[model samples]
Target: MLDLAKLASQIPGISQHFQREMTASRQRLERAQVLIRQTHAKQQDLIELHEQWRDRLIFSTATPVEPLDTRVPITPAPYSHSVFATDGSQISPSHHEIAYCYLINIGRVMLHYGQNLHPLLDSVPEVYYKSEDIYVAKQWGIRVEEWMGYRRTVLESEMLAEMACGWVNPPGPHREPNLALVDGSLVYWFLETLPHDARDRLLPPMQAAWSQLQAAKIPMIGYISASRSLEALNFFRLNACPHPTPNCIVNCSDLLDAQMPCQVVSPLRDVTLWAYLLEPGQRGPLWRSHARILNSYEECHRVYFCYVHVGTEIARVEMPAWVAEDSTLLDQALSLMLAQVYKGYGYPISLSEAHNYAVVKAADRVRFFALLEQEMLKAGLRNVGTSYKEARKRGSIA
Candidate 1:
């Protein structure tokens, strides 16, 4: 029961508010676009400003590796290449359930182009029911769902690296290039906000996966669709600041909200900027992220990203420093991504396929618990029972 009539009554007010916001947003976008053009005209000067403010930036900003306005057109993809993608889903332990356990299912795909080998698609599902595994969330001082999310990310990275390592091209001088892709950001931004012990526990294994991929020279990328990241927009704001020293504490501390100079470019996102700047199949210049979490990552594992226009939408694509620094690999990766997007008609096909395998539907969950209960009964654990609330939600009498 949702009250549809009540919700419908609020639609007019919601539309009015949204319309007002859109009107304001359009004005901001117009001003921001003008600033973007002006900034590009003097990108060299902005680079100097970035160098000066790189250390003092209070918000996350992108460091320009290539010139700010540099846009690279998509090149032709390789005749033969392989794309590997991995995605994961989880079932968090619920107190209302019969078992105190959780599960992680990793769906992986290896798609080969212009090769005789068949595509590999499968999922690896693991259940964590041991006492140590079940209570680890409490040990980490976080909610079970939150802990599972972090663990799932780590597992996804490890699984991607494992599959990439096992990939072997057919024997010939014409051995094709292959790359790995994950669905979201390579940088775990939340890690920095966690407790020190938790941070220490998580960072090592994540870095270890990065190391494994790097050592094997397997180029890995993270693709984000409809990204709302503000790193690039924040960079523009830094450049547009009107203070003499551009120091937040010294100059802009007491300024009125209306008097702020960077307000000209405020409330713009990197995706919006790229949509206006990039042509189809073109990628904006790569920029290194100055996110705090990167401080814990190794130098080679530092996250860098660029925006790509896949003909349908602007996507934020991220990679490690190792992939970004190598020109050949970077070019190949960009082309592979574009090809995948073309195949998918907007998003990457491998990722979409992997997601299909990873998703756990409600019916599957019901079957899982039913089987678990049966097994528990076979083991003579008759005390197992579903919580009253859960039972009531499943079936109710009139």
Candidate 2:
């Protein structure tokens, strides 16, 4: 139902737009070279703005390098490591269907490196329709999908930690050291953006899961691919700033020192920055993020991340403060991640398997509705007809 010919005419304009943007981006990248050549004294100075406006300032970054392209090489994955990954999928409630129902399917995978030849896989689907679940959150102004996503994140973390708790190993060559890999960020980022009252309802259980995982002592990594974070770029701006109160509010061009190299650096991404900095199998120095979501974590469980070139793509690897502080465990974690990357085409194989397991197929959806209708009829309740749009979509050829 699209006008293909009309759409074709706009292609040239879109191409030109891309070309224009590319030219600007190249200029910005050249400016970022400033991060590579700065002195230690310039890199470590505090801005004067911190004295006056203490409320908005968060000084968590500790990366002290110039040309912004710094690197440290890491070893490969160990021979006897295990990686456990979990992912979730959901079917949103459809008012057009016979019942107001939603479903969540969690898929988990455990891949062992040395001793085990076969990887373990599992999928669990939970259906929700309880009055409290559907109505309570909605009454508080949370949408159904929003509430479901929150629950799914909690479940994934809880399950990953619970499994790690049971893992025990005696010291040996094949001693199983479990590494829990989360498909996204360690923190429930959505909660940080919500109103205090809204997040209050969700943060407790999520925090509980994080605490459990930290107690388990297994190294956990949250892999973010094509990460959109600007934390690194923000640091670049801070590094080049020459003001007593170095905030971005002042015109950046005027605020930058004449000797600084970052004047050529545009507002680029951490991924691109690291891509230029890190070699294959290398990771940048760890930096703690002052993300608002981190405040909900247990005092000892703050989250931090570092950039790594996993051969093909530069990714941000996040872990708890506990994991970051443990040098041995941290090494094992990085090694396992690199190994998983090697095993997979590019990403972690365990996460890829878990995602595939969690996906809800279209054919399965059709069968699920049929079963729901049958069950209602068996309960002596008449099945409610679906909406006309849905009915038309399911029109019988016969």
Candidate 3:
């Protein structure tokens, strides 16, 4: 028990050292918090600046600074009565698939078919193709063989286009050139897919087909139905934002923010007036008040997406814009027509639901085609008049 006060003094010195260490740690943490806050503020500023630059790139109102041809065809042409429609679908070399169907009102019915011919032999060892022991000529032959497969597929599409052209020329009896409805944008992606040699083979026929159609005064209109996957819609939405005039610096992110999910009409006042009005919770035929407009417009091509509730099943119908104005009679008639076409077919929705809106779903192509085919047939058009045998043959090649 001797010198108790002296021992207590030593303990106080150690305790003071611990306190100082804790104080230093607290100061470092505060400094780090301050740095983080500064970084976050700078990041936000950069994001705003980037958005400004993007808007200007997409929507420039000024007349294109680049020179453009302004020439219009001088000679006017006559028209015909028989309308023809054509639809094309392709399975790519990489197994990707796309389909476009359209009506050509002017030409005779034509069918084209082709396929990629590359044999993907799974059993062949990779070493056989890559071996150093193989001769140079053998390696070259293997490469050539591989390329030939792509060339074959390209040739197939060309052949089909040519076949279509052949059907158009020297009009058949009881059939006159009228109009051609193609189910896509006329941007020539189909032609681009062919090989140079195949393109050369197909170009002349395509040119001849165009000339014949033009001579017949049959207007060719490419109509792209409402495509959710298309970038065009995204761009349109961005350009036509809630603002009366879109600012140049705005991009998709800004547009996305302005859009209301599942709402067809945008917040933009001007656009809201111009575009079709969709009533909330309204469940009826998708093409109300649009049929007469479609039938009356001979040369116009339009696109629209509608949320159609057929009972409990909701379907998003991407189709050509068919309505010019509100017409109750026409709407009723169109609804009747749709009901007739879809009578036996099972709709995804139930009878009790007030409104069933259409939603986009992956792998809905087969159902879409079936509905389209039924509608077209009901509209007094024979699409690809092939019998079971012929269809079977076509299916085999595909």
lDDT (CA) per prediction = 0.84, 0.73, 0.33
lDDT of 3 by residue, 1-398 (tens): 47988788799889999899767655644543343234334543433443454334342111111111111111211122222333322211111211233111111132111222221111100111223322222433434333333233333233333433455556565443333434333333344444555445444554444444444433443333332232212233332244433443443334444343312322222112212223322222222112222222233223233333333233333322322122332233224322422432532111101011112122434454456567667887754343466456547954
Model 2 quality (TM-score):
0.87
Q: Candidate 2 at 200: error in angstroms? A: 4.1
Sort the candidates on lDDT, descending order: 1, 2, 3
Weakest lDDT window of 10 consecutive positions for candidate 1 = 166-175
Please write out the lDDT profile of model 1 over residues 1-398, one tens digit for every residue: 78998799889999999999888878888888887777777777777887786666556788778877788998978878999999999887898999889999999999999988899899998898897776665765787788788888888888988888777422345568878899999889889878888888778887898788777777889999989898887777765787766566566667764466776756767898788889998999899998888988899889999999899999999999999999988998889988999989899999999998998889878988999999999999988989999999989884
Q: Any runs in candidate 1 off by more than 4 Å, and if so which? A: 41-45, 169-173, 253-260
Q: Pick the candidate with the highest lDDT.
A: 1
TM-score of 1: 0.93
Candidate maximizing TM-score: 1
Q: Against the hidden reference, what TM-scores do the models get?
A: 0.93, 0.87, 0.27
lDDT of 2 by residue, 1-398 (tens): 79999999999999999999888877777666555455324544432332343233333233322223446678876568778888998888898998898888889888877875677798888898888877667666778888888878877877776665555332246456678898988756688767777677676766676666566557888999999887656565555555555443443433444334333465467787678777899998787666667777676677778889999899899988888888887887888888888898899988899999989898878788889988888889874668898898889564
Q: Any idea what lDDT model 2 has?
A: 0.73
